[model samples]
Target: MQRTILIVEDEDILREIMKDYLLNAGYRVLEAADGKEALARFEEEEIQLIILDIMLPELDGWTVCRRIRKKSNVPIIMLTARVDEDDTILGFELGADDYVTKPYSPAILLARAKRLIESRYSTQENHPYEDTLLSRSVHVHIPSRTVTVCGEAISLTHTEFEILTYLMQNQGIIISREQLITKIWGYEFAGDDRTVNSHIRNLRHKLGKCATCIVTVVRAGYKFEEQI
Candidate 1:
């Protein structure tokens, strides 16, 4: 089935441009001129992902994003004109999976969209760790892409879960950030060590303090400590 993408942008020109490009890329596209309409369409249609603009009528992107998170985990890529770091950080905190600044390259946006969809919806039946032994306290269910710690389900973002699973599968081996970026993000993350750090921080926070599974190696990378 062809994936459907809902684009929420106030700018008519940019919205049409994205629709054209995404349609050419073989994705079914839906367009909304404001957050209100976007939310309505989101409820009415089966959208696989969203490309949302921060500025909109009736409601802003942050609120829209928050509302969406309450009901769904569909991947969101936010479009912002502000260059402020705080804005970007707030977007992520508000549940945006990624961000693209204004005047962005169409090719880059397309690539990012494709990557997010592929990563988010990819079937995990081929995961090598499916048959591996895991403690009842620490469950790594590949098919569901979920981990339960001590019978409590831990919610992890796509990137965070992938990173944790990879580390656990290769326990005791120090894996570099570059290797992680390539394997997890599906691209070479140049000069972007912070991306890896941010995901690790979020992963750790979600895993709670008691789960000391990820060990950091100074001047190197990270490794997963074997469960005792």
Candidate 2:
């Protein structure tokens, strides 16, 4: 299946550059000059991935990401020129799956986009059963990629879901941050331990009463254990 990628960048030249790369790579490309337009195009198209620019006009990328995440868990790769750690953390908090700084190679961007898109499809195709993990009051259905805490459905980003799934699959093993970064985002992922921390924080917050199931090991990593 030919995947569609939405490029949400205001700069005409940059947008064209990204679109050209994706098109040449055989993906169906859509363009949006600003965040509002990006959201509209997202709602209208069967987009598998989104390359969103943080400095967009209208609603801005943060707003766009927050809104879309509330409705869908489609992988989002945020593009920005800023190298501020806070900005990257904020993007993660808003449900972005990946981050790419500006002045980057289109090849790199394409690689990131491809990884996210392929990961999503591969996960679905490879898992066919209603394989589920239950601990405490949290339940995660692997095949359907859905989670519920205390019987209430919870929304999670792609990365967040993957992390939770991996942890729950292992149950009591302490998975280090490096291991998690490699397993979930691949060896090429640019972000470090803080990225994993941010996602965990978000995941815990969403888990609410069942948050105790995930425990942070001192000077170690994180583990999933049934809380008594």
Candidate 3:
């Protein structure tokens, strides 16, 4: 089935434009003019993702986001007209999966929606039912995209989780920094190799005693091995 996406915006033109783009991209699109309708549709549909505008009628997007987050982890990309950095930070703090500033291209919005949805769900498809990876005190559930160290669950952002999964899946292989950047962020990924290094560092830190499983190579990128 095509993924269903909810477009919540008070502006008729923007909502219609977004709906058209998602439909053309082969997603099943749902539209709402305000937070009230948006929540109703959210409860009534199996929406895979959401494109929510900050300013809305009847109810506001921030409240809607907070409410939605209380119940689900469905990917949401916030749309804001203001360029204020605080708004962007607040959106993420409220558990928005991503965000875009106003006057953004519908095509770019569609691309981001696609990436977030895929990143949130597609990781499960690459693993077998019993494909749990183990090294020392660390246990990774590939099918579930879950990681545990010493019987405790660890929270990871989508990017961090993806990098760790990719590294572990390619265990012992010398994955270059460039290769990691491309794999996680795509060819259009703008950040330098240092971005990959930062995420790798974060992953290791979160891995606690099992941090040694991921080894950094001087000229090479990085590798994951029980022997590391």
Candidate 4:
């Protein structure tokens, strides 16, 4: 089955370049010059992943992402021209799965798209998590990539999911920020450490009482204790 990608970029050259790359990589490509058309294409097609631009006409990427998150958790990769850290955080808050800044290599963008799509669509039967992980009042179903605390579903960003999954998988082990950046994001940089911290903070907050399960080590890293 060919996975479909929706590229919602306003730039004709960039959009077409992305389309060509993805098409050559064996994916079905959908295009939209603005957020309105993007949403329309999203509704009218079986889009598995989305490449969205922030400075779109009619509807901005933030609004489009918020709308999509209202009803769906489809993976979204934001394309931004700004290099502000706040923009990245805001993108995550808007439910974007990942992002690429302007002037990015098309090959890298395509690689990220492939990874996000694969991660989003992988099922319980294919990517088993050994077994469900339970601690105190928290329940984590790895294959399904779901988390529930006290019987209520706790929505997590894609990064949060991977962070929690990695920590829990190595329960009782101290995992460093660098390790997490490499393992989860597939890269490490000066700013990536802060990104990991931001995600951990948010993850802990979402876990509520079970937040204590993830213990922070001074000047080191974090460890997920099985019994708090």
Candidate of highest TM-score: 2
- Per-prediction TM-score to the true structure, in the order listed: 0.86, 0.93, 0.69, 0.89
Task: Residues 75-156, candidate 1: write the lDDT tens digits.
Answer: 8889989888677767766667677888888788888899888877776664455644365356677666677877787777
Query: Any idea what lDDT model 3 has?
Result: 0.79
Residue-level lDDT tens digits of model 4 in 148-223: 9989998886768878888888888999988987776565222465677677887888898888888999888999
TM-score for candidate 1: 0.86
Q: Give me the runs in candidate 2 sitting further than 4 Å from their true place.
A: 123-130
If the candidates were sorted by their lDDT against the true structure, best first, what order would they fall in?
2, 4, 1, 3
Choose the strongest candidate by lDDT: 2
RMSD of 4: 2.2
Query: How would you encode candidate 2's per-residue C-alpha lDDT over 175-222 as one tens digit per residue?
Result: 999999888888778898889999999999998888888999987999
lDDT of 1: 0.81
Candidate 1 residues lying further than 4 Å off, grouped into runs, are 125-136, 188-191, 226-228
Extract clashing residue pairs from model 1. none
- Give the Å error, residue 87, model 2: 1.0
Candidate 3 — which residues are off by over 4 angstroms? 123-138, 152-160, 163-228
